[model samples]
Target: MAQGVFAITEQRDGELRKVSFEAVSEGRRVADGLGADLTAVVLGSGIEGLAEELKKYGPDKILVADDAALADYTTDAYTNVLAELIQSSDPAVIITGASAQGKDLSGRLAARLDAGLAMDCVEIKLDNGNLTYTRPMFGGKIVAKVEIEGSPQIVAIRPNVMDIVENSKEPAIEKPAVQVGDLKTKIIEMKMETGDKPELTEADIIVSGGRGTGGDYAAVEELANELGAAVGASRSAVDEGWRPHSDQVGQTGKTVSPNLYVACGISGAIQHLAGMSTSKYIVAINKDEEAPIFSKADFGIAGDLFEVLPAIIAEVKKLK
Candidate 1:
């Protein structure tokens, strides 16, 4: 028999990611709907301090695994800790963010636990006390709702899709006994990408460029800096060597759901729209009025990005 809902809260460098809270919020909703308690699982070294912060999102219990072996993320170490926790708790449903780390962890955990896993879910709800998850399929052309046949249902939610609410609940912190007995992998070295702004997948506002900018990222970079937004690039721009593939936003790249998305010089391809069409507000800047991106944008500016971006940047600065 399964117990309740368990949400895996992801943390990096002793700081909790916003997606962690969003997962907790979603898990709580499902737990409430099913008349079950919500429990949060925080795994990593030096993360005991985050227990109080996780409680604010309304979990009934906070499970922390503090150990040196868990400091750096590896599939084997993380999967081992999470698998042990899930086996002991026997949760009816487990949820995690559909991030790079989440996707990797969830798959391995599911395999270890022999549980059905749903990936990249946009929405999760209980239909008459049964868990049903909705996700994009066939290249965002179709939406599919899935349900696990047995107990311990697992899901990985897409970032920025669900609303994260601070319910102000005081969660009881419980430290779980983590068995770190001889992991197969050893982390000898780790390198992290440095950036000033939030990650593109997690940013509230994102400003992106495309080939129409003529390989000069100055206009896009300036506007992004002024707005304190993450910079992104289209497939065309990335392929042209104007930007790195790490910043690419499209079907083949990162999917983002920012509060606002500003697309400059990018002709909106279906592949690109599949990634960021869920953004709350879209502003398109292009010289061609007939561009496909204009149709999806809430605000459209049919003009040269070089001319429009500078003025917009100036206006934004004045307002600030």
Candidate 2:
């Protein structure tokens, strides 16, 4: 029988990702509910120092898989090591962040392990000594509750959805020795984003612009800067050549679940909503009162974003 919960953590350049903490924290909660120990498994080269950080998230044990080949993220390399570890450890549940890497890794890992996987889960509940996962389906039109029938249930949770509670446990650290076999892919180069601005998927607050911005993002950037929020764009804005594809928030772009999502100059098409509909609080600013975005916003401002953004920015500055 599977004995414990395993959180497969992701790291880059020997630093722990935000999702790693969330995965471990949520794993801790599930482990406590299931009356099992929680182990966090970190994979990267020279990441042993991360064990102390992982311990603060309440894992009973931390397993570090450090190898030169594991320094960069390659799908086959991570899947091979994790699949072997899971087979030997026999964890009852496996949790990973539903970020880009997490989603990719979990799907391949589940296939290799032949386990049922719940992807992009927003809520995980303990149901009668088992786990039930809630995730959006059909382009965020409907939410579905999913449960796995077999052991070592794999779940990839969306970033920023789970709270990062510090549980602080004196976890026993272990260095897992595993061979990273031949890989089909290799990282030739990496283009790192240059800025302190948080990534869209992990941002706590996001301020986004759309077609209404008229190819000018000064107002949107101003408000986002004042609120310490990441800047996002709709597909129209990106298609219009006003913003890069990385800044787009829509079904075709990145999925974000920030604590606060401010949609400025946006008409809120269904495609755009599919990416950020899971935000905790939504504020929509649009000239048309009947814009679709207003229906989902917690607060609606039926006015031109160009005229409205300065006022909001000023208020945020005053509050700060």
CA RMSD of each candidate after superposition: 1.3, 1.2
* Candidate 2 C-alpha lDDT tens digits along 1-320: 88799998888888889999999999999999999999999999888898988888999999999898899889999999999999999999999999889999999999999999999999999977879999988767788999899888999998888889899989889997888998999788999988888888889999999999999999999888887799999999999999999999988888888999999989999999988899999999999999999988999999988889998888888896
* TM-score against truth, every candidate: 0.96, 0.97
Report lDDT (Cα) of residue 97, candidate 1: 95
List clashing residue pairs in candidate 1. none
lDDT of 1 by residue, 89-173 (tens): 8999999999999999899888888889999999987789977899987656577988888878899999888989888788888
TM-score of candidate 2 against the unseen true structure:
0.97
lDDT of each: 0.89, 0.91
TM-score, cand. 1 = 0.96
How many Å off is the CA of 285 in candidate 2? 0.9
